[model samples]
Target: MATAAPTPNRTPPALRRKRRKELATAVGFLSPWLIGFCVFFAYPLISTVYFSLTHYDGFNPPSYVGFKNYDYVVTKFPFFWQAVRNTAWLVAVMVTLRTVFGIGIGLLITKIKTGAGFFRTAFYLPYLAPPVAATIAFAFLLNPGTGPVNHLLGQLGLPQPGWFNDPNWSKPSLVLLGLWGIGDLMVIFMAALLDVPTEQYEAASLDGASPFQKFRFVTLPNIRPIIMFAVITGIIQTLQYYTQAIIAGQVASGVVGNSGQQFEPGFPDGSTWTVPQLVYNIGFQRFDYGSACVVSILLFVVAMACTALLMRRRAGLMGED
Candidate 1:
């Protein structure tokens, strides 16, 4: 009676074989994505993280410098703090304004009974324009002295502030440019609005909810995820803001120097020099690749943190508690 010891339960050979086959099939399906992940994203991220710790110009071999690169970015880079402040402002203002206006415009277009298609197309056309061309065009139009916008403002007896020329107005002019191309976000909002169940509106109507109540409780809650998506993407894009800002800066500064001449970015007193511009100036302009990598790494960390925070809030918005 004392000698009886039971053996652990074991899976049957046939069942184990079936499970293995199932796993193999799943892996087969995931192979492409797995390969891509390792080859592209994983490899590049690892390389960047490693390079960020070393002093490596493009032509020379990398010299390991421990945390010195990070130290320089924090303590030595003159434009680092200004870039951070500008980027934060851009993210805050652009994301909020884009979300509000996109939703509002979507609602407006839906309310139109006739020529909805025409209005949608017209609004979306700006988003389709090449960013470089659009920025150049906007710079010309908003030119303080020669642009028609200033002339029209003058005729109407309104303040014709120097748009990109003055430090105070440069950021605002960039915000205006952003607003012009907000049609992509607006279209997404419109699609989300259209997908909201008509039954929900009817239910709210039967409950005698006011229009504000209906929108607040019905429309907004239903589309909260979409709004979150728009905000997060806008934040990411704002963090990487470069081309249009640079173009606007160059045009506004009127410093298109001779070929091979490097014009300083963040014109109008460093108002538009975002973090990406800082990276470009450090890495490409000055050829201090190490410091540039450090800044890039810092920006990457920030973008990841922002994305994670937003995604975590998404579950809460859906009443997941």
Candidate 2:
């Protein structure tokens, strides 16, 4: 027997109107963000990709020279590799040290029963200092001949090596600066540590687990997600590191912008030149917009790749947990 035709599955008119109104409200709320994304992010990204394949200074019309900019950056550009190396070194060393130091400080603060808020405020104050001002202050403090730090070393008869002025020590000095301002990371870790259930710790103690054992099996497992988030963000931040390095280099080299002469970044034999600094120097300083765009694209690729890898690893870790 033939089945009766199914009733039309149309929504009630009132229901449909309500749904449409809700959708309109949602779209209205989202419009500002959508406009901002298009104007600030999407437009700039598309422009960068287009410019990477062309030769253009700000005043000149773009001439398409497809991939030559990339080739020159890879092969002929003198400081490209140096910038890459410096950026990579910062990402590896600075990020690792910041993570460790942040956790250590966080743990220490958590153990403090009295005036923990004061200590947190003191630590976080350094992060509030403007980056340019901070870098300049640090450079002056470490100045080889006249700075108080070197003077103290002299009085103590310790061998005083130039910090930002020395190629061997510049990156290390930047690491120290990074650690000094790691209070943001510390705060995050502290929150995570505090969030860990005390019941787990009591349970572990009942099992006669050592402090380290409890931390490893209980605390770490509970806070693994926060740790991963910190690490990922730290890596991304380090990859785009610019201001401090440039300012430190400039201060150390005593290269204030002089009559039509641009101050070269990554002073002290190009030791502290980072990829982002390179992009700035190329695009604005040298007026090589195409090459700058190429470097930017490469940097974008590297950042995206690193983030993807870390996210995948985080997923695996969460699965294991």
Best by TM-score: 1
Clashes of 1: 0
How many clashes in each candidate? 0, 0
RMSD of each: 2.1, 2.5
lDDT of 2 by residue, 1-321 (tens): 999999999999999999999999999999999999999999999999999999999898999999999999999999999999999999999988998888889999999999999999999999999999999988989998899998999999999989998999999999999998988998999999999999999999999999899988998888888888888898889989999998898888878544565688888999999999989999999899999999998988988999899999988987886
Q: In angstroms, give how far residue 310 of model 1 lies from its true place.
A: 1.6
Model 2 spans > 4 angstroms off = 1-23, 257-260
Error of 2 at 79 (Å): 0.6
What TM-score should be assigned to candidate 2?
0.92
